[model samples]
Target: MGGLHADHAKPDDRPTGLPTSSATLTPLVVKMLRHGRIAAEHDLLDIGTGAGGLTAIAATRLGSDRVTSVDIDGYLVDAARDRLAGMGLSPHFVTQDATDALPGDYDRIVATVSARPVPVSWLQALRRGGRLVTTIADTALILTAWKTPDGGATGVIERDWAGFMTTRHGSAYPPGLDELFETAREADGENVKLFRYPVTDIRNNWEVWSMLTISIPGIEVDFEETPEGRTAWLAHPDGSWARAEATKFEPPTVHQSGPRRLWSELESIRNWREVEGGLPLYGCRAVVTPDGAIHLSRGRWSATIG
Candidate 1:
């Protein structure tokens, strides 16, 4: 999660790296699209046509005319179109951003990118009784919602967890928290103490990290290994930072400072999860207002994101 730059979607051949669009679609993709419940007669709009894995599957299975795929990078669309055509498969490939006016009439939509507030354009583009499958950005929480009568949607955060790259409006993503990570690396403070919990990389723990992203918001994580032990660094837009270090499977000495004690809050959530057996984020109801605000609730726990 640290010391590296990343692309939101899968590998693409934008005159950069990799070859022709992926012809050998992986099982992971098969499962991902299967969750969309693609049927022979279903009209599908596939978002983030990265590597053309899903595009190939959809076109081959449902026929090219029944499937439409879009990507922000025209090069990706062009590359995928040419390669799929080489294999006698051609789906409508649009050179447009997925967040904008999607270029298709679809009864089922599957996005390989995450959306923070689940775009309203998606709802507008989906036909009546249509289904949408995507993830909430910054979290591995999968959302599968169906169109409602009032131009809104209702669904759930699936019991399962998976993710893709976040949605982008251009060729690349915005600048990230490199400055914050630099600050976290060079800072000296006395907020030191040993913790009972082991030094764990929160990013590797899907449930906790996802829930923390929901509860804390705007937190960026970095991690690395050292001769002494493993270290995890957390930073937020509010100028908060926390670092924890320890040997394998051992208690960590923590250092933290800022308006909020980021590590302390994470520990609290972790403890809460332990006491309650599991986190409430999974298997919760997700309701999308017409304006695209997502309201999620499960029993007594609830949160809203826009």
Candidate 2:
């Protein structure tokens, strides 16, 4: 029950035995491909060509001659090429760092995994009216923006959230909890009343949280689970805290850490839900500044990106 499970499932559409670029790609990428926009007879660039599955799909839609694929790993490029060759689709594949200057501009650019922040260089790479679709890091931060006549771009968040590996640059990501597990386990905190909230899912929660981060500033959330229970951590750089533990909803027990009562925040959301019904999220409009700030706008609470 903890791991990923699609309750209302759809059949797997990926080719059997293909090297997947990322776990998030399969159904999501295939569904995007089926829409037939990325493949429409236009020149395109596929960044981070993992195993050529997406490249192969792009080639089928846009013709192999019209698509150019780039990857940081030569071996992966070669392997993806081999896979594409077997499919009789020979897209131009190159072993090069996409963070550097990519040769030639095109109508579209898509990256499966991006570790680097969305650099202004990406905006410059687009021809007027071109589009860029990429997931920022591994978070479900999907950016789909179209070029503006003024040389900037605007886009909306994709419906789902995806986590991807960090870019191969400095300041990638903080060490996982495993690295600090001993510290957290040894720390003492106050026991508090258990508060219950129905979390539909984390994937759809980004719009709300993202909007909150922008507005609240320095607010952060962390999640972990163990045999003991499920836990969510809310912390602020200013030293506020909230911790939730759910072993059973009948009367869950929670731990409060730091000055701020963190469970109270979740409780506030839950109380709102009781009166307003479930909140609407997903497909929210996101505006990225030229300087690489992310902003999520829901109805009343707008979260900002630092």
Candidate 3:
């Protein structure tokens, strides 16, 4: 609720304070922390402590003395500090890149940010039975893991959808989108196909599928909107991909391309959709080895990490 813009205050704006999440996902995340059953005495680590809104919640729920928050931006660090102070909560705040190395041992480490392969050092910083929750950017994956005695963690993808700003060691994201799109548009063999998949609404599916895409072959997801229309893409590394466009209705006109027929895969899952039933987008089990291998499952097709 901290640093909430007037426009974002509206119920339709989808506010989560963090980039990839919405207010709707906040309760889910809190539920996850509760299910993990961390002790009241356990230390909590909050990575990418945006405006300290969630940090304040974590402090309240986990105890102020037991929480620590870290961020890469000093400005944000200071701003969040003030916000936390406003709420009369004092959790240690650090201005450092989370991917480097975290300070102190924590029983629950939660990141509202995204990063590359999780560093092995993060595991070292965890006490036994500690847990880590984060979203991956390149693939929009959410990971919730626990530290085991053997140095690996096991958890699950709560949902398959969510996106976060990539962890920045420096200023921010690299400039590559424009060039990449231009290249794709200019390619000579610009053939296109069409289809549709029953994807969980982006607002609610933030954890499971996000992690699944990183390991799956030819399942890249992208979104674009213009005055002309709104569009989404699900591409694969193997050159097979699908595109869905909506100029008016909630349903979109789907287009696809490449050899692997990605839209067909999504349609396979969509055909089984039932009343009050959609493909499992969240609550899928996940396991992360010390070596950084991520595995996700839900009694059907499974996906892995890079």
lDDT to native, each model = 0.82, 0.61, 0.63
Rank all candidate structures by their TM-score, best first, as comma-separated numbers: 1, 2, 3
Give the per-residue lDDT digits (tens) of candidate 1, residues 157-252: 988877667777655566667787787777863488877788787887999999899998789898888787898999998888988888987988
Return the candidate ranking by lDDT, descending: 1, 3, 2
Candidate number of the best lDDT:
1
Candidate 2 — what's its lDDT?
Answer: 0.61
Q: C-alpha displacement of 1 in model 3, angstroms?
A: 20
TM-score of 1: 0.90
Q: Which stretches of candidate 1 lie above 4 Å from their native place?
A: 1-25
Which model is ahead, 1 or 3, in terms of TM-score?
Answer: 1
Best by TM-score: 1
Q: For every model in order, what is the number of clashing pairs?
A: 0, 11, 18
Residue 116 CA error for candidate 1 (Å)?
A: 0.3
Residue lDDT tens for model 2, 1-306: 111122322466323221223434567666544322564657888777766777888888778998888876666688889989999999999887677767788888777765434756566777888888777553556777777776666777677655445444221233333423343334555656655673222234654453344334445566665676666666665555655557633444556666666556656655665677743335667676665565657678455453
In candidate 2, which residue ranges exceed 4 Å CA deviation? 1-25, 34-36, 114-117, 136-138, 160-163, 170-174, 177-181, 190-193, 198-229, 232-243, 258-281
Residue 74, candidate 3: how far off, in angstroms? Answer: 1.6
Give the Å shift of residue 229 in candidate 1: 0.3
